[model samples]
Target chain A: MTQSLPSASGTPNPCIELSNVSKSYGLVPALSNLSFAIPEGGRYALLGPNGAGKSTTLKLLIGSLRPDSGRVSILGSPPDSRAAKAEVGYLPEDALPYRMLSVRENLEYIGSLRAVGDLKNRVDYLLDALDLREYERSNVGRLSRGNTQKLAIALAIVHSPKVLLLDEPLNYLDIPTQEKVIAMLESLQGTHLVSTHIMSIAGRLTDSVVMISKGTILWKGAIDELKRMGSPDEPIEKIVARMMTGAI
Target chain B: MLFRVLKFVLRTRFSRPFLGFILLMIFYSIVISRAIPPTGISVIISYYIVGIVAFFLAMSLATGGVMVMKSDRDFLFTLPLSSRDLSIAIFFSQFIAYGVTVLLLFAYLSQAFSSALLLVDLVALALTLTSLGTIAPSMTTKGRVSASVLLALWTSSALLKFPFTPGSAFSGSVVYGTATLVVLAAATVTIAFRNLPHVELDMVKSMVRSSSSEIKAPNSYVGKSPVSAIYFMNLSNMSLAGRFNMAGTARYVSKRVKSTWVAAIASAGAAAYVAFILIAYGAVHFSAAPLPAQIIANVILGFLAFAFSQSAITYERIWLSLTSLPPATYFRNLIAAKVLSLMLILAPFAVADAALAYLGYAGALASMVVVAVVIPGFFVLEVCWAAFTAPIQVKGDDMLMPAQFNLRQMAAAVPLVAVMGIAASASGVLDIALIGGLAIWVVSASLAVSGGFWNSVVSRLTESGFV
Candidate 1:
């Protein structure tokens, strides 16, 4: 059965939607009848423990993987459709851009492909904005992991996509870069779904949560609602862990 | 403890198929040795043996050395065993891994040598070869290339009748050759043993040093459209030679150079080849054309094409590329870029073939057509076929373990083998080769530009876990 969350801002159409979506790797199911939607300009975290189908859900939303049994869409269009693909940007977990290409080349190439207006200017903006200006000429293979993550983040939003899906966006980032990324993501005016296991990243970057466990949605609501579920001095992580393990 | 560790290393390291293949090769060698007459082996065979040995030595320096699986670092190295004992086990493992080729390569010479001293020579030769492989990982790229060049010169000197060369025994200087082998083997083994325990450190240092120093300026995308950006990127930055192993193991490859340089170097080589052909057979009066030379040239070009095809998409982050453009538009442009880069190399050779044909060289016309038309077509077909037949997600970086062997890798060779067969057959006949070449070009070009064809390829790649 499909499970659709109430729109946070009550927009009729979601920018990203997956309904009754189930995916399996060989005989092992990664997503089971999973359904979720984020309304236009809604910000949410797809939160779960390791191997709880967080990455799989993101891949499906990005149209890189097909759902075995349900529908996946970006802005009412199929995820792989030209319209949907153009509007969505993705940063996979542990993202690796072209190793032989330099930092600026990666940004410029993807920028060109996305048909960004004045690609050079856009690439310059990204390079400066992400603190990648110093390393623009360096090969991606030689960059530190944190810098690579910065380049990847720059790539995901290079076209100023209408919807962005990032898996472990903050995985390799240092604290300063993390704050910059969180600030940048917060300032963008589009739907954002960040898939991460860290509750602090979820709380800082998104306004709501979609908690999943064992391939199914366990809970969904505003962050305030999630916070109220805990007693005074309770870490949000404890409340989330309780729900994930069914101790709620 | 030493024996127990050695037994465990051997048992865990070698797969059943690997052991089976080695046994089968040994049995085959023995049968051949028994069948050949003592004097029937040609002297020319010695030249081939020298060449093969040089090639193996150079290749070991290029992409191989002692292999320590990640498992070894994670678990085995943690044990409280003696470093000397562990090194000995690893040294023996490296010996078996790298020495088998030399053993089989020389096995057929067993009947000719006939003396008890032949056993001594074979053992020494294997050790010399194994030592070279074992010492390679510790050397810098410049050092490896220098050593390889020196080895090439040494082997070539054998063809010039250097009395103490490794190939000297096959060429009938058994005493000098045996002496050389024993002395060389002992020196190399000493160096190899000294380097064995530090293989991990050397590999990391080499990888980091190589990556840091070899940066090229990013190509500009200022005026280029999206598809052409992809084309130029693939054209300017590409890897021509790489190592692929099975079981999702990482790939190690030669450094990436501008594909223009690869094509330029190839064209320069083709020019040299043309000069050789013209000089070998008088330019004015060419008789029954050089079928063997033409076939060899085509096979080499085909190999380059295959190499480019395999590495073409290895750098592609499908999530990025596919999202930027439609799959059809993206792949079509990607294939076009690779095909055009290949043409830069093939065009020079085709011109050379045309000059030969105009001079009335037999079969030169067919060879020219095949080079100019058929090969690029075959490259397109190969890229498309490989997406479905043996699609493996490319390993992300060089800092991973060596690739494993699997039967599926063999399937990737089918197209290259077929093209080689066609090239061989075409070398003798003009009409059939021309017609076949034309048909292939038409079909391949049509498929390359077809949106539907690319969609199917994208579907297949997605299903295969390439994303």
Candidate 2:
């Protein structure tokens, strides 16, 4: 129903694209006539209130959910197509990583399934990068919440996914850990679409914001543009709060 | 406030089909009672009613974990509501959900839906609840050891033991059980209030950090090759390690070996006990044996079917893990891992039972073959259908069916069951029947897969919502 970014001026095929997409579970509609496109290698933050379809959007991109109507494409092919799914990585909000599995096992299993090149090196890199080395032998069910989340993030990117969809990725982390995650994400290449209610995380990981309310795009623009619109002194959260509640 | 929570629980947890099943079971119980001549016999009727309810509660608890201990600490712990109020609300919600079902079942069995048997049932349920309360607090902790310890302690308590046996509680001693029940329930309530403020959000979601993990270096076993990282806990089945290239397969085998060892021990014990009875009676002959004996053996084989299939369905966790593997490979590995685990666990017992029994070793060998190969392989197909369609809610305890099933699965299963059930019926000749039955089921299952049913199942699994 709305376009959040400027009209496309470059390549016609964006890395991630959803055209007039809509999906509903039972009587409750999740995404309604949603349309958005992220150019190849774009980094964007998805903002919406709880149940505003941020997770739904990510699921659609990863082929976890088939749109009831409209289309979802990854790298110019259907999201569910083998080629598209192979290139996508997802971190579900709950991040249940086979509770019976140890951290290293989960990493290795997902990495091999992903058929990532040099699978061993990739698992090793993630185990080290995500700070999950210590609990590598412990069952995921035994890990602390922060550790589980780290394992989840690791699993998502274990194959060095071409497109990453992360939802509330910073939830439950200590401040220092949050900083490290942000720094790591900033260094990664490829398209990253982060969904979070935390304004600070949005500001740090992405320069563009795609804001939706009640499952439809409410606004899309540069974060700087959003900050500028709030009169030179207004906090961006205030502007976001108003926009999310339809007070804008 | 408590009622509000109860409403939410009922709305969320009870589905139309689940409620329908409960009603059907109640009606079936009632019809049987009326059809029989037990109306005039109060003792028989009351015992029947009490036994049924107690069995349901125990079975549900053993399988689903202690329902009475359920806590949605997510919202309640953070709310302004007092711990006492929260405790009452949580207790009553579980009470109405499960407790009411017991009452309804008892009432239906007595024909009037309100005979004097209900008071006994209520007392038994209350004792069970309080006993659960005393042990419930400990289950919140993870791992098998803590639970086993608590279960041992609870079983040893006289308060729990008195009422659970069939006729004792309904006799004169129910009052003591009732009083102990009240005291325990009160103590549990006090604990709940004290702990509510201190409770944390169940999600210990410390979203991981980008910082290096606590371990300074990778394990010595791990090298550039991922397979070298293979290791296991004391409970694991490390035997299957060297063969599979799939890391998922390795992970699966390690986890399974823990339960497999336990199953093997239990199966061995049961087999030895049965074998000794057979050796003593001098009736080792299997085929050409009485019909009941064959039925008894096949029932165990049926359990193997239920167990293997239940474990194979991954519920909500396999979506990402299996996303890249080809459909055929995924299904293949899934079946292999599940069947292999069952055979490894049960094969020794199968061999021992067949060898020790007076029945010719050939019959024992044949029965064991059925247990080791036929059931596991066929059940895996049954599992595929169940997981794809209406899979039963897999719990820690065994249900009539491990996962849910729908019309398609039921339709698929009927022929297999009829063929196997009929074939396994022949006295002493069950092994012969089983072999033939296995061939038919395998061929049908293969056709189901080749006919695009397998793909549909896979697609349903990967794209479906949380289990």
- Best DockQ among the predictions, by candidate number: 1
DockQ of each: 0.56, 0.15
Give me the TM-scores of chain B across the candidates: 0.83, 0.60
lDDT of 2 by residue, B1-467 (tens): 76776665454434444455556766876677667544433554544444453444333232222222114444445668656665555445435334545444444445532435445645445434433422333343343345434443443333233553333333333555445434544654565445443433221111111112332222222232322122212123321211111100000111223545566675776576465646554553434333344345655555545544544554326446444544555555545555555565556655655654444533444455555556655666666655666443221111122112233433433434643564354223555656655774676367445625555555465445541
Candidate closest to the true structure, highest lDDT: 1
A1-248 in candidate 1: lDDT tens per residue?
12233457764777788899999978999999998888888889998888899888887777667788999988888887888888899998878787777898888888888888888888888898899999998888778889989999999999998899988899888899899999999999888998888888888999899998889999989988998999978999999989888999
Candidate 2 lDDT over A97-213, as tens digits, reads: 755557887776666556567767777888888787778877565678898888888888777777888888888778888887888888888898999998888999999999987
Number of backbone-clashing residue pairs for each candidate, in the order shown = 1, 18
CAPRI tier for the interface of model 2: incorrect
Deviation from truth (RMSD, Å), model 1: 4.1
Steric clash count of candidate 2: 18
